[model samples]
Target: MRLRRHSLPEPRIQSKHTGMLQRFYNDVVLALGHGCGSSHLAGWRRCPPALTIICALTLGLSCKVHAQAAGNDADNANNTPAAPTCLPDGSGSLKARLSGAVQAELVWGNEGTECTGAVRPDGGIRVRFSHKDGVDGGRLVLLFGIAALREGQSAKALPVNVTVIREGLGEFYSTQGDNKCTLDEVRQEPLVGIPHRSRSYRIIARGFCTHPARAVRGNGVILLPRFDYVGRIDFDAEDKDETLEGGAMTAQGRMKQQ
Candidate 1:
């Protein structure tokens, strides 16, 4: 008479857990059959009690370890912080309505935009705005010739030199040899979270052009009836001292006094 081989019934559960459990069952059944010289369920009934207990313990331990590893992976993913973005707080912007040669409502914001300002050696402040990695983009520059500016202070009707450059197109100046645009009002405020020693101030300004900016080498003109922007300026020790002194001296006067 030939002995018929018997296979273990598969677990009712259908998932990765079930697959793992099935593998463990197969291993145990193989070991029991080897010890009893029969690859069938009858061999399991004939195996020693200690051997069956050992197989059961091993399967439980493996499943527990796998579950712990999966839990650790999930916890690590949850604890990771998100990446930081550029200019997340919308601290910088430039908005304006243009007419004449360049006619468009220009709105540049913190995204992909860079604005920088510094104190000129002559006590002037120059602010520039441009696009990041923009080889063929537009650029705006504002020049303020004030001797000193302070936080929470406002200046009005100040003469400002404006320059707009459109790469591959042309360059326009408020006045080639004169002032055609005036800052209607500009207010300065201390930027929070910055160290006092850094001497950086946020400036918000609105201005308009009495005449259009004529192209340097062309007959083109870009008219801006109104424009506004938020920018920053870094000042030095000398500039700070000038602001503290409450002196209404012109840039040239300060130079002469020095």
Candidate 2:
């Protein structure tokens, strides 16, 4: 298959510099013409002054051309985008690989609970996940918030579907709608049996008032977050809204199971 080539945008010229050069060129030409006219009335047999003016005019035109060329070069330099940098191995820049399961917890923006329909006094939290190796596929175990409040009882894990959009920056996943499950709660949970791949991965979670099954539709990535790595996750529903609308994004990290 043939790859298509796209045209780049034209470089912008600096208005101030362009105007200055234009004015300089006009002044030089006018000076040359004025001097030539004055020299013609000097009573000289030959118009020696006019000839000298001609030479000066020619030099000025050359200088203007040179200046334009230099300006174009500068414009082109400024317009070029910087190339992407390659990450080094074992750089300690990212600690994605963990020995076991990563915990997911709620951090902010909790209005209510989906299961019990109880009003949440405190808001929910957003969860974020970062890992070495790209997060390919994973299972999520969702539990109700009030259930965890009971003595000697843990929140039950509900089945969930996962999809990752951006590699390292984050993945999108769906969970059952509950006010207690804040973005931070989702980020602090563990993602079990995820296949390992090479790349840094970032996972962020947000809970909406919608059902988890409804959120998994279309193209989205999912993974549970643990308490340790969940602190880095940020909760902003506006971002989730964009993803829901199929917005474009660029990733600064990658994730996979170790």
Roughly what TM-score does model 1 have, to 2 decimal places?
0.50
| Model 2 C-alpha lDDT per residue in residues 1-258, reported as the tens digit of each score | 221112323335467655555564456534554444533434232456656765686677668878888999999989975432212121111112111122223322211111111112233222222222324443222222221221111233322222223334343343333431332322221122221321122232232222222223233323333221112211222123233212221111112121
Query: What's the CA error at residue 151 for candidate 2, in Å?
Result: 23
Which runs in model 1 stand beyond 4 Å of their true positions?
Answer: 1-88, 132-152, 170-172, 192-196, 237-258
RMSD (CA, Å), each prediction:
12.5, 18.0
Clashes of 1: 0
Per-residue alpha-carbon lDDT of model 1 for 3-28, expressed as tens digits?
Answer: 44554355675766666666766676
Candidate models: Cα lDDT each: 0.61, 0.31
In model 1, the Cα lDDT at residue 149 comes to 45
TM-scores, one per candidate: 0.50, 0.30
Candidate 2's displacement at residue 29, Å, is 5.2
